[model samples]
Target: MLLLLLGYDAINWFDGRFSLPTPGMLAAPCEFIDVVVTERAAVTGDQSAVAITFAAPDGSPLPAWSAGAHIDVTLPSGTVRQYSLCGDPTDQSSYRIAVRLIQDGRGGSAEVHSALTVGTEFQVARPRNAFPLAVGGYNQTTSAVRLIAGGIGVTPILPMLDMLDRTATPWSMIYCGRTRDSLAFLSELARFGDRVTIHEDATYGPASAEELLGDLTVSSAVYTCGPPPMIDALRAALVDRPDVEFHYERFSLAPVVDGREFDLRFASSGEVVRVAADQTALSAILGARPDATYSCQQGFCRSCAVRVLDGAPEHRSTALSPGELDAGYFLPCVSRSEGCLTIDM
Candidate 1:
């Protein structure tokens, strides 16, 4: 018995469950409703992607969400990640999200891929939509629409396609991926038929602006979700088509542009936070105030909006109105300071 205790029990050799116990599975807060992982399915042939479906524990209807909406998923490791809602928004009973394994990412995708079982429990914040369909109704506008998706970026665009098709809106889309097997949501996109274009980097060598835009010379509304490089190329291409209403959302943070290094003094604690030329003020300040809240790192959401107490703040966020910016409100996620600035965070 002692040898058995030392051999298989102490060392745990027979049933090797060497993995650590995760947090939030046994007892979660009352504030967050529990959603059990109801199903997990392979979404890509590469075995690097999965679609997870969750439902309320009590079979109650979940919160209603729209296309381009995302929810913050609190993982077992206490990591919070935002995933786009790829399922039909009208299906209020449950929600589905697809995740692609990013080996070089911050380990969130790897956790989702390896740890999320069908019966796993987790919490998800209420859905928030930052990038919404420009035209909700088909009869409201006559302008054409262009939807572009890159790789796993197709998650958010899937619901958009559903909404646009349901509303009878005229639109076309370009889905770019490294290979045909690497792309997710192909079955969903296939229903759209010739309206969808599949551009594989394996064959096309990467989509150029011209290939992406594809005779989009008219004054149309263009919506895109993809990697930063794809978004940047599309942005540069649209520089000439000023009439096109360009709305884009990417999974990654927007690169800080034209940032100047400066010191940020907090009004509450008088803590001087240094901002690097390439780092966002919000990113730098998080080291000091871990309790600070922010969403939509792209600056569309005003979750990180702080009041400027002193010094000059270069307002780069598109969220704040002219009156809001003039009234000392600034978004640190994208805004920077020219001089030593004081803010009431």
Candidate 2:
């Protein structure tokens, strides 16, 4: 199966063929309800686990989500961040997610840690799932499922593990992090007994991807999410196991490339902004239009994607595929222009 990004949506491109959502299918209404943070605690030494409750101001049930689903949170500072739902999918009263503070990050995690508290009111985009679990393992030929997660990537996997356990599916997990103290959901995962393996970098150093995945047979299916390096290593190790279906989700941004200064012409605003070699097009665009809609400034989310009207674009983000570029879309958060460019804004 091939995955392609066209604008902000992910299209399942299989065997050089795919179907686009029709106008009616793409026009579902969404509600951004004001949710109150009901509980907040440190799940790990460094990660803060938060639970937010949502209900209609007039008392009605909020939207529901599946395992591996995430919601876009608008922070107190107006910075948008996406967090995977780690709590019970059956609980319609609340949603839980873990946030790890990134000291060098663009202030989203920091704002989440400092500003969010019990009783604090916040707004979030309804849950959306880009990484969904294949119910009962999509590979009918396989009965074994392998789940792998690294660092904070374990958030989404928690729900999958829960569903699998309840269904009595044959599955196992490999969880890795810098240290035991940095890992979350330890006590819960412990219930799975020997089926789960934890690897700490400080104690065990790095776990061999090949060794961890070597036992998987052609009739096995694997799902994993983590930093790009770990994902790349796992993919390389399992390259020979094409018969075993692989599902992955990556939230980290691609490395930024050195870019030259370029002129950004906004067709809608009739404004011209200069993007410097050391700066991002987002910074320039947001500086001029503070009301600009954007999220996940690291280029993980396609919230800042725009249509290119002219000139060549130096696409630095992993958000868009080759097909998306050919369709004239570019992510301004991390991507820059090869030369002068005009944007639809």
Candidate 3:
């Protein structure tokens, strides 16, 4: 993604997308709510994915959400995990999200797959739409919106497809995965017919990110969710395609690049936490302060922003406003300091 710079004082858009917020953006709260698992099903034949539905115990309307919203689910083991709401946004009776068992990931997914069941009660933060779909005005340069998904990334795009269809908007999607068995919701995509394209790496090589770079192809507005390599390739290919309005949500936190070890000192407690080169300041501080609040491990959500007492922090998250940065705020999730940072905690 391209990074943009304003004047010397303003801290340019830090998402690296370097773009303005599109239509239908809404501020979301991080408040938690009580809910129970009303239904569960395996979307993938290989048992890799489990589609779970949650609703209020009394069946009251849940919080309203947009197409690309996600909720932070607190599992039985007290592990918090974020999952995109794939079900209809218009439905207030319940919210649906899917989880693909990630053996190599943190233990959250494993506990979800093993312990989450019908009638399971848990707390989930109200839906937060970090990837809101562009609704009202379509980009004039591009005629339609292109939806792209990779592997389990389809979770967010599913509600997008429904929203486009309901509004009678022109759009298409390309779903890529390692194989057919690994891709979730094939039967769901079948409803869209030829508008949806499936590329499995088992047969054809991985989908090329360059395919959408052509002027005649890929709508002017493109939204994609996928693993990093695919997302990175698309961003690199679109670097020169300035006419295209591109937005993406990554499946995981970005690895700290050119990272160096730093010490984080707490101003209130007078304690210190050593952040390794590969570790985020948020992760390192969480070990010492388990009560610290955070939602998206990615930097875009400002749930992890802290006030910097001292030191030069390399701000990497877009969530903090230029004014916030000027006020000595820092996002430890993605930002790193040159040497040591004293924070308010």
- Give one digit per residue, the lDDT tens place, for model 2 in 3-47: 212122111100011122222111113356777777787878555
Off by over 4 Å in 1: 1-32, 136-139, 266-273, 286-295, 300-310, 318-331, 343-345
C-alpha lDDT (0 to 100) for residue 31 of candidate 3: 70
Please provide, for model 1 over 1-345, each residue's C-alpha lDDT reduced to its tens digit, 9 standing for 90 to 100: 000000000000001111122221111111355899999998987877899999998889999999888776777775656788899999999999999988777677888888888999988778877777767554555367888988888887899887887665579999999999999978777888999999999987998988888877456777888877888888788777766777777766656778789999988788898999999887887779765665445565465677788999988766677877777877777889789888875
* Per-prediction tally of clashes: 0, 0, 0
TM-score between candidate 2 and the true structure: 0.75
Look at candidate 3 and tell me the lDDT of residue 125. 81
Native-to-model Cα distance after best TM-score fit, residue 166 in candidate 1, in Å: 2.2
Q: In model 1, what are the clashing residue pairs, if there are any? A: none
Candidates sorted by TM-score, best first: 3, 1, 2
Taking all chains together, each candidate's TM-score versus the true structure is: 0.80, 0.75, 0.82
Q: Write the per-residue lDDT of candidate 3 for residues 183-254, one digit (tens) a residue.
A: 999999999999888888899987687653333344456788878787788877777766567778777656
Please report, as a residue range, the 10-residue window in candidate 3 with the lowest summed lDDT. Answer: 6-15
